[model samples]
Target: MSDAMTLREITDFAENLARKAGELVRREREDNTLRTDYKHQTELVTHADVMADEFITGAIRKRFPAHRILSEETMPDLSQAEELDTPLWIIDPIDGTVNYAYGHPQVAVSIAYAEKGQVQAGVVHAPFSDETYRATKGEGATLNDKPIQHSGATEPRQSLFATGFPYTKDKLEPLINRLNAMIHQCRDLRRIGSAALDICWVACGRLDI
Candidate 1:
């Protein structure tokens, strides 16, 4: 198949799968019976995260068995090459598990397609807001099917920054220092819980950094 056609297909599939996984996240948010577990001392993981990861991995395997998968929940091998010969699907089934567990709407489903370590297409779905942000290399980006632009604010004082802090205390000190430095320079700061959503916000002009 032509490279253009292949990229188009990958982008579409990524957006669809992200939306599907996002729906699962939303449903799991409301289910009081859903179990929460810890992957680390403070990092949270829910059944919904694994369910969404499995769902996306299963679909990718069935549709493109030759491709490799690297997921936040399931990473069978840690020694994979940085530049792969085959396509790689990097997935974060639930980008904000802590928020999702708390029924916060900042969670999202993130999927990106990479080849030779370069991301070619990506999709981030926010089910709570019913928004889908998608991008392909050289194709720019879109929010809810409408083209979007960056804030383009060059001055730090005019930029609204968004960031997330690590859950563990050991890593908090440095992040706090960075936040302290940024707070003095930027207009304001926000911790939106999900990195994918933060990035989407930056793309669509919701955040400047």
Candidate 2:
């Protein structure tokens, strides 16, 4: 809990917490009875999301009791948003709630810490594959405790780009326009349905450009 904890210590702690959350998600991945509901007409959530968020928040509060936690399902007040100026945790316990609801193995537990507008650390865990990606400000990134690198290849032919499916709405036409552009520029684009997984794949060189 000490602010004096080294980066290595923070990474180790975050790694452990990420794995714990992943384990929870993996269990949910196999459960076909997860009750789901729509957060909006497009966005969704499941029992898994609730449980995972609770687990991640508990871990953060236990260690850095004074640190701020910003979760997707529950957010702090905008008036008190400055509390994030200190050690803060941004947690998306289940990044692909829609995928998880449909029994797709494309969800993840993501926790990133920021201090003073800079990302201090990030840990993303995919329980289905036991693939865990960790990154620190300058210490580089890793997967399953091994060093990982980005796919450096930028050629569209050899590169595989990933993105989200376009959301439908009367007022969000601009996002559809931008997404359509990317879909055309890449030889192939996949919607993994999980942002954490998408970024982790980019970090581990599994996907590129």
Candidate 3:
């Protein structure tokens, strides 16, 4: 690995693992009986989430064992600088677990890589839509490899910044109030229960500003 941080390597790694995760989702979605439980409050946990996280994280470990994995379902300790010497992968398996739990097609897998504490790359895969979005720092962004642009409102008042109901009490009420303000400011508001997909849509300008 060179200082350049090859875009191809990161892109391919994320895309491949994302596709694998998607397949797992598809399998369970088709089966229609994937076991699920609550992780916290109303947040969900499923075997699919477990399987998908394992699949994606396992692939990363196999390809780059030295890299640290920080995911929604699993935690890996990397308190030392040397531990994060190479890369850090942040992942959310089955990002829209609530949707997936009910056979909704809005679920997705999100993978982001931080190189030295900065988001060097991001990949969002919506298997149900067959749409994939990827972004690399200083290299531009793309949807399904075609160039994509951001259409988010330059002004916070006019912007439709999406958020989720916080799983923790510390931010729950604040998040709701923030969302209410955004709804009033924006042309309209929408909540999809998936933060990754919301961020991706914001990146592509599909949602209102």
Which predicted model would earn the best lDDT? Answer: 1
Clashing pairs in model 2, backbone N/Cα/C closer than 3 A: none
Output the better candidate (2/3) by lDDT.
3
53 in model 1: Cα distance from truth in Å? Answer: 0.5
Candidate 2 residue runs with Cα over 4 Å from true position: 77-85, 166-168, 171-176
As for lDDT, the candidate ahead, 1 or 2, is 1
Select the stronger candidate by TM-score from 1 and 3. Answer: 1
- lDDT tens digits, residue span 28-62, model 3: 88988699888665667889998899888888888
RMSD of each: 2.0, 2.6, 2.8
Best by TM-score: 1
Candidate 2, residue 85: the lDDT equals 56
TM-score to native of every candidate shown: 0.93, 0.86, 0.86
Mind giving the per-residue lDDT tens digits that candidate 1 earns over 1-209? 22445787889999999999888878877667679888866788988989999999999999888888899755645365465677788999999888888778888999998877778999999999899999988888999889999989899999999988777777688888888999999999998999999999998899999
For candidate 1, the 10 contiguous residues with the lowest summed lDDT are 74-83
Indicate the residue-level lDDT of 149 in model 2. Answer: 90
Best-to-worst order by TM-score is: 1, 2, 3
